[model samples]
Target: MAQRAERTERTERADAQRNREAVLAAADALFAASSSPHGVSMDDIAAAAGVGKGTLFRRFGDRSGLIAAVITSRLEPLRRTVREVQEATGSAPRQQVADLLDTALTFKIDNRNLMSAAEDAGISSPYQAQHYGWWHETLRTALDRVPGVHAPEFTAHALLAAIRADLVAHLLDERKMSPEELRSSLAAHLDNVLGAA
Candidate 1:
């Protein structure tokens, strides 16, 4: 009887894990195919996930909530990377700053939909504050290594704003710059701005 109960528990856990994966995968595909975050419906997500409507709502609460869940999950790796960089690196501030910029840009490229979805969800005020706080702490820690630098907080904000999806998309779509060129320009611009401060 105990063995049977253990097997049942394992099966339930596996099913839950599969459901979570399906939801996120469906969300990614739906978001990518849409021009805007609002363009995708809950039904679209459900169909893509091979899930019932009840499952999605039961797991994610609402569309905005689903977006938040997806974004948070996708960002987990990025947050880990930044945290590792902060802990493991003994390099100069200039290199560390560049590393942070590169990582942020890479993340933006890979998770464009999550960024768009987050914006569309109207995550303002305290949400924005928490976001900035995380970036500022990352920036301040690295910026301390740069010679004769000040205002790490403001610099962090500038770096973040400059590397945002809208700006990068504008550069790619409107300006027609290649990814390599955009990255080069971004790194140069960041260094220039930090140098001035």
Candidate 2:
């Protein structure tokens, strides 16, 4: 009897994992195909994923929660890369700072829709989450190693704010800045921030 119950629990967990992946994939496709985040609805995601709407709610809580999950799923690879860079030895602090911000900026640019969905769902406050703190602390650590940067804590925050999701969307969607141009401009800005280091 106990073995049967254990098997049943394993099956349920497998089902849950499958459902979560299906939902994430559906959300990603829908967001990518839509011009705006507002166009995609929970019903749309549920239908595409072939899961009950209740399942999404149960697993992710609500619209913002679901969108956060989707965004987090997309961010995993970038996070892994950043972790490796953090763990790596002998990299210059200035280059580390640029690499971290550039990697983050590229993710925002590439996955603008995911971030847009977070904004549309009213989950756009970056500072409210541990994710934001992680970025800030990592950047501050690198900035601390640099010779000339003052107030590394505030410098980290300022640099992160510059590449924020809404700003990325505005620059790309409204002001018509190309990714290359934005990257170049950020590099120049970094040169100023790093101050000849």
Candidate 3:
């Protein structure tokens, strides 16, 4: 009887893990497909995942927690790329800074809906995010390496603000600017900020 109970516990753990993955996957798909991620709700996710709403709350604590988990999962690859850029050999500081901002801009443009949802859920400031510090420090470090760049930290913050999710969304969605046009403008802006190379 004890052995049977142990087997049942193991099965339950496995099932819980599967449910968590299903929930994340469903949330990701729903958010990506939605024009407005704020329209997605915990109940929608639970239903899509074939799990109870209570189970979602039990696993993720709350809606914001679940959204954070989904964003973290989606950002893992981008984080890896950022790390690689940081560790790459022989790239000039200006070039590295440009690369970093460009990478972040592309990510913001791609995931603006998820980011907008995060903001609508009351996570209004990127500084409140765990990953924000890493991004800031990475860009600040690159800026520091550049000889003529003044105020590395502030410049880093300013550059990040330029590519912020809401700003990107506003430019693309509201202002009707093309992504290519946005990219070109960012490149030109970076040239002005970095100043010759």
Candidate 4:
């Protein structure tokens, strides 16, 4: 009897893990495909995942928690890319800074819906995010290595501010700026901040 119970527990754990993955995948896909991620409801995610509403609440706490989880899972690869850029040997510090910011900006542009959903769910400030500190530290370290950078910390904050999710959305959606134009403007602004090498 005890052995059977142990097997059942193991099976239940495996099932729960599968459910979690299914929920994350469903939410990620739905948000990515939607024009307005905020329109996505927990019911929609639960239905798409083939899980019960109670399961979602039990696993992710609430809508915000679920969105946060989905975003975190999506960001894992980008975080790895940032680490690779930080460790690359041939790139100069200024170039590294540009690369990091560009990488993040690209992510924001691609995932603007997910980001907007996060903000609508009350996580509006990047500073409050768990990953924000990592980004700030990475950029600050790179900025510190640059020749003419006077304030690495503040400069890091300023550069990150330039690529913030809402700002990117406003530029692309409201202002109708092309992605190419935005990238060029960011490069030019970075040049101004970093000055001539």
Better of 2 and 4 by TM-score: 4
Rank by TM-score (best first): 4, 2, 3, 1
Collision count of model 1: 0
| Root-mean-square deviation per candidate | 2.9, 1.8, 1.8, 1.6
Residue 120 lDDT, candidate 4, scale 0-100: 78
Which predicted model would earn the best TM-score?
A: 4
- Estimate the TM-score of every prediction: 0.81, 0.91, 0.91, 0.93
Which residue ranges in model 2 land beyond 4 Å of their true spot?
none
User: What is the alpha-carbon lDDT of model 1 when measured against the actual structure?
Assistant: 0.76
Off by over 4 Å in 3: 1-3
Model 2 lDDT tens row, 79-98: 78888867875788888989
- Candidate 4's TM-score: 0.93
Worst 10-residue lDDT window for candidate 4 reads 123-132
Q: Which runs in model 1 stand beyond 4 Å of their true positions? A: 1-13, 32-38, 125-133
Error of 4 at 58 (Å): 1.1
Model 3: number of backbone collisions:
0
Mark the 10 consecutive residues where model 2 has the least summed lDDT.
Answer: 123-132
Q: Name the regions of candidate 4 deviating beyond 4 angstroms.
A: none
lDDT on C-alpha atoms for all candidate structures: 0.76, 0.85, 0.86, 0.87
Among these predictions, the greatest lDDT belongs to 4
Compared with the true structure, what per-residue lDDT tens digits does model 3 show for residues 41-88?
999999999999999999998998888888888889988877876786
lDDT of 4: 0.87
